[model samples]
Target: MAIHRKRFRVEEAIVGEMPSPEMIEEAAPMHSEIMAELRAIRAQMAKGTPPAPLSGSAAMAAIDASTAHELSEARTMLETYRAQIEQCEKLKVELDLIHDAIDRTKREIATLHGKSFDGGEMAKVNGELGAVVGGTEQATQQILEAAESIDQAASAMSKVQSADQQKRLADDIQERVISIFEACNFQDLTGQRISKVMGTMKFIEQHINAMMEIWGGVDAIKAHVPAHVDTRSEDDKLLNGPKLAGDVGHASQDDIDALFD
Candidate 1:
């Protein structure tokens, strides 16, 4: 038995060493021609037919060049994407900081007011208003009842025939008028009480504004409050004070009565 050795040469292609421009230029035409021919052949062939083989050094070089180009493009794209992602993260952090600032503002404002949205000051104001209303209502009712009594007395006095009876009736009328005048005194007292209540409300409002400044404003208030759906329309948002009793889309006294009925 005879053993034969096949010898191959080793070419040292150092770092950064690449195929010559001449070789690449030479390979280009052949590569284009071959690719064009192959494409034509594939076009002529039936569907699913295996394509022709390309196996020369030039063909390999061309493939390598193409692959390198694709890799360069992919690397560029990856760097761009990374930069974009970094920017997005930065923006997100800034947005978070803005949110924090807003929350802080709201908390400060809440403090100034001595209360929050459903704060103690508001409850106190509510109680005060209720007391004022009750007092006024009671006073008005008493006046009405007194007036009715005066009317009854006048009607009876009108039917009297004697001078002495007339004199007595006139005296009773003066007394009733004096009683009416006394009933009106409640108004002065109620006005004073209302003025006190108004002062309290102003104080509460000023404190609330101070709280806003302290907390960071609306943001802080919202953080402490639970999220609720805003059902008001753009128009409704501008509305102020109590709505009319029988307004559209609102339940009136009749509707309330119907619940019990």
Candidate 2:
């Protein structure tokens, strides 16, 4: 039986709108690469490898098979590219959340540190600390002075200051020292606030570290951002605000002043 070549209109994907020049430029390389493969296949056909004076139905089957394979390959590429784009979008969202968290955490820490220690705020806390410390110091000195007075009275007792006189002097010293102790209650108030501040600082530090981990650990965070080292001394650190009374790390006002010198 003599076979006739089948005539069929090839189905092509229709363009709904004209592509922009930029879009065409972006697509050109992949288009050229695919065309190159199709050309190589055609070249082999011309060399008569399939010896295509193929019967008409056989020819149609060959075209269908090749078209199907190419379409399958295109679909695979499109699916892979779409998956990559989705992955990129998800990554961007995660990075943005972590970045925003870092910024917010930093602002809160700054507020805890006194809103970047704005001049007015710094002075206010400084004044509060100074007043508390000064009051405590004055109360302590009064106690010392009272003790010295008692000592002086005892020293003079050798001059036959009678038992009644010595007893009266001792009673006066006891009342004065006890009054100073009462005045030293400022420590209780200051300690509560200072402890609260310490707790806030620890919480901020932990939150900052968590943000760092989200951004991929310390090394990754460093890779993306510059690191800053605090140049403030240990004493300066303690003196940043009021410390508990007799805190060994606290710098005296004079010591802090000497830092500038």
Candidate 3:
């Protein structure tokens, strides 16, 4: 085998020495660029490598965070459902109370109708009132007629000179007075008829008060009350009947006499 050897010149020999501070400063930019390119090559190599699995504590922390979030959402939904249930319960209770009230009102109305109209109580009351009016009118006419007859007999007695004629006139006046007394007996019948009418009216009033109580008291229901409408004609409105005992705001016989005076 042939032996070959390469010879190096002394001027081309390599040397080793510390770099100057100015040279280091001038190479700073190149050093940074080289370092950045080396980091980029490392990142490309790491992309193909599988990442290390999480440690025990890190994995547990991630799982706990997810569980806490889910639990919080579940609690919020449960709270909303609980509130809805409470609202539904309140509405059900209110509806039940209203239904019971309606049922009671229906029963009361049926009872009132059955007793007042269907049972003929209203008709009986009307008939009784009519009888009272008729009896009062007949008695008044009879009394007036007797009074006129007595007045005529008294006037005749004053004019008569004979004792027999005067005695006859006095007897006729006595007879008329007795007739007036008998006509006054109609007051007893009027009282009985009025009592019957009063009883019927009282029954109706009791039922009406009960109906009013079903909704609320008179004061509670006052706002719902409709305005009253007068249906009477002007002449009918002026036709007030005789005042009862203890009635005020009406003119008596004494007041009329005073006016005349």
Writing each residue's lDDT as its tens digit, candidate 1 over 56-95 gives: 9878998999999999999999999999999999999988
* Strongest candidate by lDDT: 3
Off by over 4 Å in 1: 1-78, 101-105, 116-123, 185-246, 249-261
Tell me the lDDT of model 3 at 36.
100
The whole-model lDDT of each prediction reads: 0.74, 0.73, 0.84
Q: TM-score of every model?
A: 0.43, 0.47, 0.67
Order of candidate numbers by TM-score, starting with the best? 3, 2, 1
Ten contiguous residues with the weakest lDDT in model 2: 4-13
Best by TM-score: 3
Model 3 Cα lDDT, one tens digit per residue, 131-159: 98899999999999999998998888889
**Clash counts for the predictions, in order:** 23, 0, 0
lDDT of 1 at 180: 74
Q: Please, what's the RMSD in Å of model 2?
A: 21.6
Q: State which candidate, 2 or 3, has the greater lDDT.
A: 3
**Consecutive 10-residue window with the lowest summed lDDT within model 1:** 6-15
lDDT of 2 by residue, 1-261 (tens): 334443333422353355645667789999999999999999988887775488989999999999999999999999999999999999999899878877876766676566424677556556666766787787778778877776776676656558988787777767767766775776786676566555555665776677667567799977877687889887666555676787775678899799999
lDDT of 1: 0.74
